[model samples]
Target: MRADRLVSLVLLLRRRGRLSAATLARELEVSTRTVLRDIEALSAAGVPVYAERGRHGGFALLPGFHTELTGLNHDEALALLIAGSRRGAQAFGLGSALASAMLKVVDALPESHRDIAAGAAERLLIDPEIDLLSRRVADEEVPGTIVAEVRRAVFAGHKLRIHYTAAGRPPQWRTVDPIGLVTVRDRGYLLATRSGADRTYRLSRILAAEELDEPAERPDRIDLDRAWQERSTRFRAGGDQVTVLVRLNPARQEELLDTALAVRAEEAGSDGRLRLSVTFQDSRHAEWALWQLGTDAEALTPQWLRTSLRDRAAAIAARYEPP
Candidate 1:
């Protein structure tokens, strides 16, 4: 990351002013030769880095030469750093560009506030794969080339042909009028229309993509949020959705909510636990979610679920019984 080192070198000179090559090497943790090379690179890139020849002389930027971060305050700069580092940014194939931009963002910030903003961003964590239950989150694999092609089609307003494989379905070629792209929970989706019907294709399932030269026959103006919302509404409406009544330890409530479609009703009981109605995609989904809570949750109305958990627990207990 010579580029990062170069940015650091400039920041150091901008902050401290006229530090010797040895000092820049110490701060950048690189050899003085590397520091000199970076200074040369910066100067070549029109960064106005000049070296003075004397015992006290060192590298420094021209006076009053700085890149303001568009008046971004400390918090705003911190937010940009955090957002740029999210793995979800990779969903749209912007990882490299985002990294470069974020570096530039830090580079452009006022020198006095720059270090503090960069340090603060390091303290915040977002979207780690492992949860409190130690279950690793799903990270779907998607080819960068396919995403790049799909992104081109979506932004260029061109037709896209994709060899898409829907779950439990064979890969089939679909030509879609690209509308927009959306990334939810680290999964990328292309929102398009086929013959005027809405179609959403997951990026991971796209085995191949070809951007057609023909322009997309999509609405000139679209409310992407509204379109995605309608599709989500339809998807939830069409599923074998089931609502379950359950009681769970308040501490485990988040775990249940993570697996649920939505919370229909909730009540905090006298026992300091939650009694609630929650929806899942189906009965199996509801049963599986409750079972994960072990004794921390109880299925109140779903008798079959209770029986299922009871039978599962009994079988486990029986296996551990003494001979």
Candidate 2:
């Protein structure tokens, strides 16, 4: 706990540049005595942390104390910037601050490294396709005001009042205790505690958000990273666990196994036919898979699926009939 407190104190000084013992104690949920002891530990560890005692004083890091990013190679630094850009560089609450910080870092780099960094930037380009019709399916810019509120709630253990719309539903306002933000694919999600439970909501669905004055104590036993991982795994697993048996030719079998879907291949008899077992999230998705296989694969089990596949084929044939 002391180690954590010390690290947090150092980061706080780095981010805010100054903080009072009372503020640090409240943020870290410790007493002023404990905070002073942790500060002492940090100073003992050569953290360059110092405290001031007066009417207009607290604790501050010595001027010129800064972390150096000299270890990163040129390619690595450019990769970081490009990655940031993909996450809505202009829309993130810290985007301008990050850009300013990056400029300072670039200026501090050696001349040779600067040239390499420039070259890498010129060579890296990200072209994301924009879809304008569907707000639900598009990546919209996160409002700066909302971004700030979310960050404050996450860091300070405060609750947030958010106006949001669930999929296929009208907008409604609710209070959520902020936890963390996760980016799935290119979209952003807020993992929060709602109605005494954890839930994930799309950032785009949030019309407005604000921090509450009331603070919720941080959970003592929660492992947020592990909780997120388990939730994501269950979400991927719960959708239609149906397995389809399909017969594929040797050439198509290889291609099917290389696809994004989970497909298991096995030899069937000695006639160059292969058996493939595929799991789909839903019957509709399974039907789409069967459509892609076309005439190359045939369903071997599950009478309902086989019948559905037959009906679909018949419908397609009827469509191609006379006119």
Candidate 3:
């Protein structure tokens, strides 16, 4: 917080050229004495900051003082601003504060570059759905206080006392050593290790969570990045692993080959139809794929799948016919 207040003071001086101690204090919500001490600290750190004592005089950054902002291209800057706006500006924790800090960076840019940045921001509109999905999962629906406390516990390596209610189960209290938080498909999950278990719980299922004062040693083996990668790989690998054989018309064969779901293809008979071998995650996904090909495609192997598809089709047909 002190570091944030220091940065804020620097940006304020950079923007307004001169601000009184009282004004800086009011803006930063600190006392005038605190503002003066912060200015002294900034000057001590070789920031070229100074103050004047008199009516209508105040603290100001010396002329020609500039800080370099790195790694941001035109598109990146626009994208960053657009993302901040979509995060509701205030709900992104430090992101909102960082967004405000970006304004000073924009102010420091040359007029031509500034106009380019502004134009890009206005022309490149990020869709709301994509923006919403990009936010921190904990911030999506949970109260700010809970999100903050959980984050604190995770960072401090503290244990959490939580009341969780799984689907089809009664709510019960459990003590978990908070490992980390993960966002999967826009859902927030607490990657905690419970007593005698190795898996984590989704935080949304938690009816109540409170941080404990006791700290625990951080686990060296709990790599979040690796866990995320493994989860994605396993999910993709686990989808119906059955080898499906389908006969398709020539035109339908071309369509099927163009799709990501098509795993393999081969000529079926002299009639010029094709036998496609595909690995699908589930019968439902395969059925959907077959439906997209309409009458041109027919399942050839896995009799159970074919029978199931037929029964489903018959049931669907029965719903529409005259009783």
Candidate 4:
């Protein structure tokens, strides 16, 4: 409402010292005319607001003026409580810190919102260990010391040396310009540049870490999200990408989707099965996903895949033949 907006306008001016009318409107998500009116309203309400008439000025609040606003509203309080309860905080080794902050938040909330927010937050769960299929989610384990060392380097903008082991490769020590850390799907990754090339390492695969004294050589500003997206796009487009058509049991649709690189098209068959065209990184990837479904999915094309499945099934049957 206007009261909240006025309070926000005062707070913005207080924190920023001085801001242009256009800037205030943009920050408050209102129009310049509305900002002017809010400024007049604040002045009329005995607030020490003043305007600096100049090509480079708009509005300012007199120094030493402050308002004692109460804590957040109910929705804001509940949203923060719910977000703080997520596992993402634990991935960054901030579980204890997050717990402490949550306590402060609960205590600072208006008495009417405190109990309700906490109770509502308690009923929410995010990223549970066990999925709907009864399969346990595997949480990748990384040593706290290793994570702390890498985290220190990332924030300090220093070079770091790490003993890293890629899949099917022996551990090797490499010095890298540390960029930042990212956590997705309950796993952590270190995004950095190796030998001037973008490299992402799974935190679980980092055996040891050492922060170097030399400052890292990197751009002053980085768009980490865009960088990650570009790398992910390159990765998905790499390798012998393959697309396969399959008819899968409707009940197992999620399983197929979870394993495929991407879904191209999907439709329901007259037989009640789900017909889907899915892409995988390669033939091996396609076979792995289809095989996981066993008899629940049938690969409809790439005669070679059909023959491979048939031969594999025959061998399995022979192995279990009555003796």
Candidate 5:
């Protein structure tokens, strides 16, 4: 770990020129004293690192000195390229940085592997602004300034205040202790707590944000994955869940499961259709998913849901019949 930190310190100075110990500590999530020790270690290892003293003093690498530790194998380089292709980074306001880093990674590769890797990456495409199906998935509008403020608060362990608007509600301001930020499928969320109660806020819906002077009330160490999972499980179980029994074409089974919350049971009908018992978010959710399947699926139980689908289909049929 210490060796990795020392190498990173050298690379940082090489790339960004002079930087203060305080800045290095913030970037490395360590203390200024630790950064000073690492600088000493790098110099002791003949890295040509030097410190400038006085009011505007910091650490820097000698001119023309560069670290040779950016040697990534072909597969590793390709993986980085694939990660760079994702749109998630753009949602979190790191799009330009990601692009710049990818360029540096490509430039640092050896000549033999460089052309092949770059060409191969070109063949792969992801998260296009517009897809072939003509589905207009425009990027979610997350204010860069607000996102930056929230990020600083999250990383610096400062409390945050945000003006958020929930769906079908008026915008309101609230103070929260931000635990972390999560971005999934190009959407960003602030996982936080307000007055000791867990709250999740959509970043696109945050009209304004301010980082408070007070420290965030959160644990010093956090297991983000575990916390996210726990929150997700509780959310899924808390909604008005409904169980649905349906008969669907065998070929369309995958489609039904894709929209379902859970598949409680599955069995094959004598006629080769699939009998599926699934859970959905609610009655409206079940109705909508089944309607999309058209004649390929039929609801079997819960007369209300069956009636809802029938009414919707009849409404559509009425529109075209003799009108």
Candidate 6:
């Protein structure tokens, strides 16, 4: 660890020319005394490191001193830098590792491209904790220990035993052959099979996990995309799916489409509104989504859904009518 820190110290000086002891300490997350000692170590090792005196005094590498670390071009470096900004790695319990790797990546880039690539990456943002309305998007917390165990099983072709908490149910322990992990919309899921039946478990819902010594019963090589698609198709087809026809304001079409499971049909209304026949996971899902749109959308068919929405509106209106 100290060796890596020493190398990073050299690279930091090489890139920035001169940095105060406090700045070096902050960048390397070490004590100022540690930076001073490392500077001496570098100097003793004939690394052309020296310190200046006075208020602006700091450590500096000799002029024209640089290590050769060239490989990535501009675009490639930018892409990698942008990837380092993602929070997806945090979902897999690798946040610290990702940060360290990103630091190493920047250090290894050619000096000519390092600052520009890193600076450009700062301009790009990834996940946001809050939306435009100030409503927060809460990230699901997956235990690092659990994630480590599961990840190890997945990569090592071993089975895993987990205590999973399904919706409105008690936690039950099950042994599974994990295929891979997926993160979507900030939620992480472990794609696995139990008793040869595909099962998806939310990582947050895993109360306990243990990797088994036995090998997993899965293909030697998996195409995760293909596997995920097949499982998704089967899941969508097996759910309590319902179709609802709705008339919505053209501007609100996206809101409806975003929540709908599928758009069965679409047409423009004579009144300039949009007509959409869409599928929902269930009646409750349909009711909740349309209710959010208020006057912007109307349930055209499926009289039961229209009735439910009307009753819901009536209830809300009754509350504020008089008393």
Backbone collision count in every prediction?
A: 0, 0, 2, 0, 0, 0
lDDT tens digits, residues 1-323, model 5? 89778878887887888999999999899999999888888878898989899888999989988654265543344335446546766666666656665777778778977999988989977777777898878779887799889978998999999999998899999999999977766788899999999888889999999999999999998888888888877876877898989999999988988888789999999998999999898888999899999999999988999888888879988998984
Model 5, residue 41: distance off in Å is 19
**RMSD (CA, Å), each prediction:** 12.8, 11.5, 13.7, 5.4, 10.4, 13.8
Per residue, candidate 1 scores C-alpha lDDT tens digits across 1-323 of 88778877878777888899999899989898888888888888999989898888988899998865565554344335546446666777766656665777778778987999988989987777799999998877887788888877887899999999998899999899999877787888889899999888889899999999999998889998899999988877777888889988999988898888888899999999899998888888888899899889999977877888889899999999999
Q: Report, for every candidate in turn, its global Cα lDDT versus the true structure.
A: 0.84, 0.74, 0.72, 0.85, 0.84, 0.86
Question: Per-residue CA lDDT of candidate 3, range 1-323, in tens?
Answer: 99889999999988888999889999999999999899889989999998778898999999999764665554335436545454433332334445555776788778998999999888876434434558633444555566566767887799888888876799999877877776544456777767745446665677777899987445755888787666556654765566689888977766666543447556567778877787676777777777788778888888987887788789989999996
- Which ten residues in a row are the worst by lDDT in model 4? 73-82
What lDDT score is found at residue 64 in candidate 1? 93
Worst 10 residues of 6 by lDDT: 73-82
- Model 2, span 289-309: residue lDDT tens: 777878887778777888999
- The RMSD (Cα, Å) of candidate 4 is 5.4
Write model 6 residue lDDT over 134-187, tens digit each, in one string: 999888999899998998899889999999999889999999999998877778
Using lDDT as the measure, the top candidate is: 6
Give candidate 4 regions above 4 Å deviation: 1-7, 10-17, 20-50, 61-85, 240-255, 263-277, 301-304, 315-323
lDDT of 5 at 22: 98
| Worst ten in a row by lDDT for model 2 | 71-80
